[model samples]
Target chain A: RKLESGDAAEARDNFAGFKLIKVLNENTRNKCIFVHGSFEGSDDDAVVLMEKTPFDKQSISAMLTSTTDLKQVMQNDIYGVYTSSPPPDLNGINTTIIYPATDRHIMKYSAQQIYLINETAEEYQEITLPFIESQPFSLQWVYNILDKKAESDRIIFEDEDTDTGFILLPDMKWDEKLTENLYIIGICHKRGIRSLRDLGREHLPLLNNIAKKGKEAICTKYGVKENQLRVYLHYQPSYYHLHVHFTHVNFDAPGMNIGKAHLLLDVMENIEMQSDYYPKKTFTFTAKEKDPLYLKYKAAGKM
Target chain B: RKLESGDAAEARDNFAGFKLIKVLNENTRNKCIFVHGSFEGSDDDAVVLMEKTPFDKQSISAMLTSTTDLKQVMQNDIYGVYTSSPPPDLNGINTTIIYPATDRHIMKYSAQQIYLINETAEEYQEITLPFIESQPFSLQWVYNILDKKAESDRIIFEDEDTDTGFILLPDMKWDEKLTENLYIIGICHKRGIRSLRDLGREHLPLLNNIAKKGKEAICTKYGVKENQLRVYLHYQPSYYHLHVHFTHVNFDAPGMNIGKAHLLLDVMENIEMQSDYYPKKTFTFTAKEKDPLYLKYKAAGKM
Candidate 1:
C-alpha cells in the first residue's frame, strides 16, 4: 500500500478517515467492545477490529501532534481505519471523534468508540449514534440481569414482559448509614436498552409502574410511602448500562448533583418528547483523577 | 508629608505594619463592619478602626504593593492603621489567605482570632467565650419574622419564648419533591446566638432541645421519626444568626455537603468539648458570583 501526497494532506487538515465505533454499553467487570462501526455510507456497515491494531506511542504522538497518513494502511482496515468510499457530503461528515487525527489517537485497541451519557441531558453529542438496531442487544450484562430478574434474592418485582425489574443489592454497608437511619438502595433495570436514550413514548408505563405500584410495595413492606423513596440515575454511570438508584429520601447518596441525577419521572417525561433526546444533548460533570473515563479524556488532551 | 528614600526599601519587602482587624461575620446585605483587629502584638487586646480612617485606593495599593512607613500618618490613627505599642512575638504572623482568592475564604479577622481548629483531628480547642451579653437579641430580621411566625397564615409553629420558631417558605416549588413530597424548609432560630462560633458548653441544652423535642414535634406532625429527619448548621453560616435547617432525609438540599453541613449532634458534641470550636477552625466552601463575602476578598486583591 502506498500513501499519496493528497492522502497526507487529507490526514493533516481534512482528516478524511473512518474509525470502528465501539459501543461500551455494559456496566460489569467485563468490558464488551463492539468494535465494528456503522457509518451510513461506509463500504461495510461494520468492520471488526484487527486483533493487532497499531497503537504504539509514536503513532499516538503523531496522531495528537502531527499529521497521519493512515489511508495507506487503512485500505484493508489494517490500523482500525477503514478506507471507505467518500461519503456524498464529506464536509458535513462528523467523522472527527472529539478531535483531529482520530485514527492516529487510538492509544489502545479498546480505546476507540463513542460513549453515550444520559444524566441531566447528554455529555457528548458530536459523534453519531451507531445503527443500534444492527445489534439487537444494545447493552451487555442485560442477558444475565434479565435471567436473575425473577429470583427472590435479587428481584423485588417485575412487569408483564419483564423488560423492567427491581433488584436488591447484596452489600449491607452501613458506615455512611447510621443504625437508626435505615437505607435501601436497589437497581432498576430495563432489559435490552443501553441507557436512558432507549426510553421513549413506549416506556411511559414503566416509569408510572415504578411511581405507583413500586412505591406502594416499598411503603407496605418498609412502612414508607413512594414519596420517601428517591429514584434516579447517575450520568456517565460507573458502567455504561442504565439502571435507576432507589434509596431513602433521607440518605444523602453520591451522584445526586443536579447535573448527574436524572429523576425517573423527569426521565419519563423527557422520553415523552423524544426517547433519544438524551444522546443528542451536552452535559457537565466532575470527573475525578481515578475515574477510567477521566483517563481517556486526559490521554486525548481534552482534560 | 514628604516621601522618604528608605520607604522604597521597606515597601519592596517588609510588610511589618499594624492593621485594625475588621470582623466580616454577617452574611446579610448590610455588612456590619466590626472594625477592629487583634494580633499577638497589636496594642491593647485590639484597636478599633476610627471612622475617618483613610482607605483610599492609592494608600491601599501602596500598603499592599509597596512599603508602608505609617509613621508619617502616625500623628493620628489614619488609614485604619492604629499606632499601638507592639506586643510579644511580632514576627509570628499567619496573615496569608488562600490563592485565586475564593470568596468563601475567610481572612484573619476577629473571626480568625477565635479560630481554634486542629486541621488534622478536626477538633476545636477552647477560647474564652465572647460575652454575647452585649445584645440580648440575635438576627436582624427577628422582629418581623416573629410577627409572621405565630399567624397560621405564615407561621408553621412557635415555641414558648417565641424565639425558636418555624415559618413556611412561600414557594411550593419542588423539582425533586413531587406532589406528596411536601417540603417545609424553615428557619429554626435560637435567641442571642450570633453564629456557631458563639456556641459554648452553656448552649448545649439548646442543641439537645433541637435533637429531642424538635425532632419529636416534627415527627409527630410529619409522621417521621428522629432518624428520618436531618438537622444541621452551616459553618460560615448563610447569615450571622444561628439557624438550623430541618429537611426530610430524602431531600437533596443545598449546603448538604459534609464540609458545609455540621450535623446537629456533631455540633452539640463539639460544643460540649469547646463552645468556641467553630471560630477556631478553617473551612472550605464554594463561592458563587454576587456573594458580598466574595467581593471583600476581591477588593483585597485575593481573587
Candidate 2:
C-alpha cells in the first residue's frame, strides 16, 4: 500500500521535491532499502522503501546467450567489480549496478535470521494445536473461495467431488508469467482438516487427486511439465486451511527451504504405508523470534 | 585456490598492475563477479572473480546501533539509492557501495537452477544406488584422516568408543571464527556406512552420540548453546562418506535447503521407529543439469 501510494505520487510529480533525512534500516538479506524522508514542503515524516525484485528466467537467459557491452570499473586479478546497465526494460531504478557480489558484500552492507523448530507429535498436540485453536485468524476468505463466492474466475481448475476435491488457483504472489518462478496453490474442498498434521490414510484419495489434477492443470494451461514442478505442503503452515503448493522447481521460494517443506509424494507414501504417519511423525519446522510458537517453545523450555 | 593465489600475489604487489578486459560471467545467485583480464604489462590471458562475502554478526550489530552520516544520492518519494562505505575493515575491496539494493538490481544486472528429483524406493535401488556404486571416487583421503595419518592437528574432538566413535573437526569452509556461522563436521569413525540411505536402527547410538557430543563440544569450546546449533546431514552429499554437519542456526549455509538437507533428529527418529524406513522411503533431492545422477535419471526416463 505504501509503495502503491508512492508510485502514484511519483507518477504525478517526479521525485524532485522529495528529500532524505536519515537511514532507518538496511535489510541487505532481502535487498530492501528503507530510509526516513519527507517531501520538500511537507512537515510529516515519511518512510521510503526500495526493494530489489527477483529476476525472471528470460532476462538472465538473454544476458548469458547474447553479447553485452561490459565496462569494468575495477579489477584485482581474477577479482573485479563492474557496473553495467541492460536496455531500460531489464534495468530498474539503479541504472548503474554492480553485482555477482559476494555474500560478504550483501551481509556486510548491513544484516539478517530464521530459526529451525523441531516439534514432536506430542509437542504439536500440546503446544501448536492449542495455539492454533486459540489464536484468532479469519479463514472466511478461504471458505468463500471454497464456496465459489469469491475468486471463482481466478481458479485454474476445480474438482467439485465432496470427498476428494480441491480448488487450484494461482497464489497471490505469482505474477502469472509462467516463468520458472511460477507458483500456485491447491486448497482442498473438504474442511476440518487443518495442515499436514491433520492428514491420514483416509485422506489419501483427496491428496492423490489434488496432486494429479494440479500438475495436469499446470502443464495444460501454463506449458510447465510435471517434472518442472515442486509439489509440497508446509508444516506449521501460515494458515489453518490445508493447502498444497505447486511451484516451479527452479524458484528459490521462501518458506520452501528445509525444516519447513515436506514433499507431497513423501507425505502420501508415509500415509499409504502407515495410517497415522502424519500425526505421529516429528515434523521439524522454522519459527522466527517473534513467532508465538517460538514464545511457546521458550515457555516450555523446549528451545 | 585461485582466490588464495590472488591473495598471495596481492599481498606482495597490492593489485597495482591488475587490468580489466571484459566480464565473463556474473553469478548473482552466488554473488560472484567473474571476468577476463590480464596484468598491466602482460598479454597473457587471465581471469578475475569478485565475490561478496557473508557478513558476520558483530559487524552488523555495530552498524545498526551506531551513528552514521547520511548522504542521499537520489530520491523518488518512497524510493532512494545512496552509497556509503563502512570503516576499511568492515568494507571489502569496494570502498564505496550502495545498500539494500533490490532483486531487480541484482537479477537484471546478471542471473541462476537446481532441480528437485523425486526418487521412489524402486528408482533409488534401480538407478541411484547403482550409479553411486559405479562412480569412481576416492575415499583414501577420508581413510587417511580416520587412520590419524592426516589432519590430526585439526581434530576438535574425538571419542574412541569403537562402535560409536567419531572425529569432529571444523569444516574447511569455516574460518574458525566463533560467530553464528560457525560450522563443524562429525565424521563417524566406523566405516562401511556410506550415506543416509545405508542407515538403520542399529546405527542410532552412533548418530545420537554425534548429535549429543558434537553439541557439547561446540558449547564448551565456542560457548554456543545447543539451541543455536543446527545438526543435519546432506542427502546426495558431495561425498559418500557419512558425516553430520553442525552449524549455527543463523548461518544460511548452502546445501541445507529443503531437498538436500535432512535433520539428524528426524533421521534418527525415522530409523528408530522403522529399521528400514530410509531404505523403503522416497527421497526428494536436488541435482544440477550436469550431475551424473541427473544423466542417469534422464537415461531411465524418470525426468
Question: Which numbered prediction scores highest in DockQ against the true structure?
Answer: 2
Q: Per-model i-RMS in Å?
A: 32.3, 11.8
Query: Candidate 2 lDDT, tens digit per residue, A1-303?
Result: 222324423221123444555544443333344444455555555544444333433454343212322343433322333333233233232211112222343334332245667788899989999998998878999999999899999999999998899999999999897567888999998988999998998899999999899899888998877777889998888799999999987787766766778889888988888888888988877676778889998899888
Per-residue error (Å), model 1, residue A174: 6.0
Global CA lDDT computed for model 2 = 0.66
Q: How far out, in Å, is residue B299 in model 1? A: 48
Name model 1 segments beyond 4 Å from true. A1-145, A149-154, A164-189, A273-276, A299-301, B1-303
TM for every model, in the order presented, reads 0.31, 0.73
Query: Global CA lDDT of candidate 1, please?
Result: 0.38
- Name the lDDT value of residue B231 in candidate 1: 65
Q: Best candidate, TM-score-wise? A: 2
Error of 1 at B173 (Å): 25
DockQ of each: 0.01, 0.15
- What interface RMSD does candidate 2 have? 11.8
